[model samples]
Target: MNRTAQPAGTPVRSVPSKFRGPFVRWPRIADATLALAMFVAVTSLEEGPGDSLVVRPVVDLPPAVLLLFAAAGAALYWRRHKPLAVLSVALAAWAPMLGSSYANVGGIVIVALYSAGRHTQDRRWGPLGVVAAVGAVTLDGLLLSLPAGEIGFGCLVMLGAWYMGRRLRLRSERAAQLRQEQAAEAQRIAAEERTHIARELHDVVAHRVSMMTVQAGAARMVAAEDPQGALEAMTAVEEAGRQALDELRHLLGVLRPKAERDGLGPQPGLTDLPRLVAQVREAGLDVSLTDDIRAPLPARVELSVYRIVQEALTNVLKHSGPHTRTEVRLGHDQCGPGISIEVLDDGQGAALQSVSGTARTTGMGGHGIVGMRERALLLGGTLDAGPRPGGGFRLTAHLPVQPVLGEPA
Candidate 1:
């Protein structure tokens, strides 16, 4: 069916309440019409206890006329939203004739029984229906005016249908509960796996990338002035690359046994700052650095610091075409007991140019600054990248003293 309801289990009931009609009201009305049509077509069977109904004591309904009035009541039976109200009205309308043993009016009661059960997928509608049907049939037949056999048969039919609806509703409820539990469990497992992957990546990837950054810079520096010394730094970069690849491969294998099919990732980090400077220098740019980092740094913090520098310098190398001197400064300070790294380029910085003249500057960054900031935050540090005070672009990051992973809780 083209339904908006959940596909798995017990559906939320849409009862015909005082506010709105149930979705099944129209279909119910159709069912009633079909039943009445069947009865009308079989005109020969109109031999209900008409004489018996007239002399009946309780529920004064005339059996022969019950079906006609019931067909009319069926109109409102479609609005079974107010179940008790509708059923009471139908029953009360013919209460005087209920004394008849074969009260033909029971057709509407059968439909009502089904409607009452439908709300819960047929769960409820107690055995009281059984007792009421049996008692009413017996007492009306024996005491007032009904054939004992006819009363017995009518009660049996009503209870049977009610019982079937109750069973269907209960089964649907159980299935729905099972489906919900399975979904919740699947979500919980996925969340746990993501957390585990994050931990593994942070520990392995961050440490190797930090070391590669330093080594790459040193390699690029001596390549021209001292080619042999530069070769040694290059060797370190190659070694770091190999180690990172091997470790990542092992980690991935552990994380996903099937990942042997996928290849290894690239090697990159913060330690290659000097080589990065050399790479910039190679492309005809003046870059200077003042590093006085005495204390041992946290692995994640160091790696984040490295990426920020790498990305910021990349932006400078890409946009600051000429007439620029880049100054990179890394120092251990007591700014609430932390270490800070700052990279500033004295180029045609947008923020600075706006202050210097009435003219506008070139667009330098959009995603680069965002990337640097993201890296910093990932390592539990803060980053600030913008145009410098003088005439340049400035990118800075301040890291706490303690490593987040191993810090005393």
Candidate 2:
């Protein structure tokens, strides 16, 4: 399915107020302290200053004008909470502050411009901030008789702060998107793992149970007429049941939570085919195995081969005619790459008919074929199962082994 949300990232959660550090949790208090410091620093400047760095008051400010300057500095307390409103208030009082030559208060205007760009969520803030910068520069140039270079440089400084704030906002948004993508990928992987487990369970349970059913029925049919044959049939039934229980327990152990499971035992592999063939023989089916590849197969490839052969044998026992003879062949071609497997059955077309009929059955059928195909595809392989051209059923699989088995002989 196509992804509807981001993948491969974690979700960004909002930071709780309790963990925002002391200053962030009480922003108003922090702003008040900063405003008080600015007020004291401005008021304490020496009025009879010579041509020193300390900017002397150009005009002696009355109490009213002094109050306006103090008000502009205090308005910074709400810059983060109401950045647009704070900037507007600072701009309203900008002319008076410049006219009185309160250069220190210009620092407050620069700070307000930075906060407006950085914190304002509204898109309109961008053009509004530019307008505020242009208006401030024009007023200062006209009223204070400042040179063009000085006014231009001052405007550039305000714009630079605004640009930096905008850049930071974009960076934060990108990080959030990446986190979302990562989260989606994690969920997808989990779902795929679950499906793989379910397929394995089906392969383990179905083969053993089908054999048990055939053996039990044969024993019941011949019990009175042939007592010795019935005893042997019952014994085969017992063996099939035990083997099924053992394999089921092993798979269940792997599925248990890590803390609860003691450990995992060995999984079935190609070497176990002899025992598997013997078990099917107990159900009165004649089966033969042939192998030519001398090299060892990788664990995954070996497991898939074992399960494929097991499922094919189970199907033959369940649906083949009374006189069917089955043969299993395993080999690696020297001229090509990968391993090849084929299970052929010479029956009265019963196995072939079952395969075709099962394909059309909804839900219940086709799972065995689908499971085998899934295993082959996972290891870069292909599978084909259908009626043989002459008179029987054939299932074949070609699984690539170059990465695992290396060069062919």
Candidate 3:
């Protein structure tokens, strides 16, 4: 994803009400106030006795002319909904005033031009309205023999008002588009996080459940032959159930809202491997571990590594027989800046053919191998799993590590 960087300390600007829609808060009242103000200003204008320009006092103007000016100002109340119509009415009224004492009705024209540019939904109509307004002002000035400079100044002022409104409208559109993009990005990230949590739950629950299943089966088989051995197997099954609930509770806590969640236990890491190995031993798997890591890794990397190893051992127990010997080795890579891991098992048990057949048919038990590979790749690592040429299963992974700031590489 690409993001545009905003300047440091720059404040975000919200879209203004004028650009949001045709009306603002209490639209009728606001329009009435503006119209009344324009009427008062135009009526208050007066030409001094010695003035060269043709202007007049409101009291001296004819009643029809006064009514025309009043009508022009009144038309502004509907400017938000009918901007072009209001502009046309104002210009028509102003045309009669030109060369007369009240030719200074351009204020009404300016307001109408702004409303037309800001409120018009059709793109073509706004520019067309502006052009028509400017042309009317120019033609009226030429017909009345008004000074060229005066006409040019009026046109420029009206165009400036229209341009200001148009610019704000475009800005409002861009801000709305940016907000929509941000919302979509947030939803996408949330979906991905949910998927990751589900995979973690699967790994945690599957291993413990598989252990309990094996232990319960063993206990049933030996109950008649060896009462003491059967009791031990049942005890192991109970312990596995308790551990599964504990880990499930720990994982589920994350799904709760922050205010409702209590403090959770720390996730298993490299230091927890001994306890993990002991649990597997009780489940009847002959397993060994060799840890040669010299330096500590980041917490996230440690958690991912622990999960990869846990899932691999779970697969071994599920597919390979309990008597098969497995070895787990962890160490820093001798040739690169990374950690290396390996899990291997000897195919000496009765279930070796079934394990190899499952590997060939189903690609290592559906979601298990895929989950392990996802964990490794997320940490900038690579994983490989398959049957060895010498008649066993082999899983290897290499995870790259970045040195922490202020730490030696």
Candidate 4:
């Protein structure tokens, strides 16, 4: 039995959860025991005023009434699995017991009506059972020449039994439907998380791999003419490859069960931006980073800032001209309590054009920009990425951050 993670405000049954386990595990045994108890109780009824609702029953009752009571009780065993048929059998036995001293089988009929309501497959079966039970009770009333009020009372009692059964059945169906809906919602959320993880992998791995490929190509080109340049390029390639591997391991660590990820290491955040910028510079691009926000930020906010800058610089490395110069700015905005990040590059505007096929950021056309924007939106922030008015590309992101109260802002 797979459990679903229900969202807040999802309904829970009033019944205690503890009993559900036992009931589900041994339903047949429980049903059989109840049937046996009803059988014994019904058989013990004797000739008395309250014994039979049949008003004027006197003479010696035939032994066949005992058999009818026994049959009705036996039918209770299969009440849940075959509700309609079980109720029919119980009613058949019940009609014959009306004029006798053994009218105690009325208990069995009530249980059967409730069972029919609770477990019947067809929705129409409940109402039909109500009619049948009422008719049976009405005919018994006529046979015993009972008054109108007594007959109506018996009919109402049977109707109530059927109504209660139907109510229980409806509630059970509703609960099952809610469980199904909850499962579907859980699956949808899991899929979104998986998509987020894939995007993170692409942003991290693609950038590093792109740099390595460029460096490897440069090494090959300069090997004969500039041995020192070639050596430096190879060094950059080695470093990029190592960083790519480390990031990959970190991303994959999340796939482990929570308990197993105890020592997997922390995620890279804004604090690690200097090392990141250094590696980007070694990739042969002219890049500089300026940081002024000394306050600690939330982990997710820090990660979003890092990826935004990283993706911008990656685009510079992949799609910009050789002379491209990039600047990264990070600081807390004085106008509001938020962190602001800007990545600008004089990269011939090709990267922006590559991403903006529609000339608007609203479309979320590319995975890189779309993913970054989604992260920002999730954190109640915003991002803008496109060509600058001058002759370059620019990416800006802002995320609201509330400093721990009574602590540094």
Query: Model 1 Cα RMSD, Å?
Result: 22.4
Arrange candidates, best lDDT first.
Answer: 3, 4, 2, 1
Worst 10 residues of 1 by lDDT: 1-10
If both were scored by lDDT, which would come out higher, candidate 1 or candidate 2?
Answer: 2
Which is the leading candidate under TM-score?
A: 4
Worst 10 residues of 2 by lDDT: 9-18
- The C-alpha RMSD of each candidate to the native structure, in angstroms, is 22.4, 20.7, 20.8, 18.6
Which is better, 2 or 4, measured by TM-score?
4
**Candidate 2, residue 253: how far the Cα is off, in Å:** 13
In terms of TM-score, how similar is model 2 to the real structure? 0.47
> Candidates' lDDT values, in order?
0.57, 0.69, 0.73, 0.72
User: In model 1, which regions exceed 4 Å deviation?
Assistant: 1-45, 48-72, 75-80, 120-132, 143-153, 214-235, 255-409
Clashing pairs in 2: 6-181, 7-181, 7-182, 8-181, 8-182, 8-185, 9-179, 9-181, 9-182, 9-183
Model 3 is weakest, by summed lDDT over 10 consecutive residues, at 1-10
Count of backbone clashes, every candidate in sequence: 23, 10, 0, 0
Model 1 compared with the native: what TM-score? 0.44
Instruction: Compare candidates 1 and 3 on TM-score and give the better one.
Output: 3
Best candidate per lDDT, number? 3
| Two-way lDDT contest, 1 vs 4, winner | 4
* Tens digits of lDDT, candidate 3, 1-409: 1111222122222111134432465788889889988887677674445543443456777898789889889999999889888888888888877766576678898899888877776677777767877887787778767789988987888888788877877887877676565444434444566688889989989999999999999999999999999999999999999999998987788654342267656866899888888887787788999999979887767777787787777667767768779999999988899998898876565564544454432342145554565567677777766566566677788888774456443
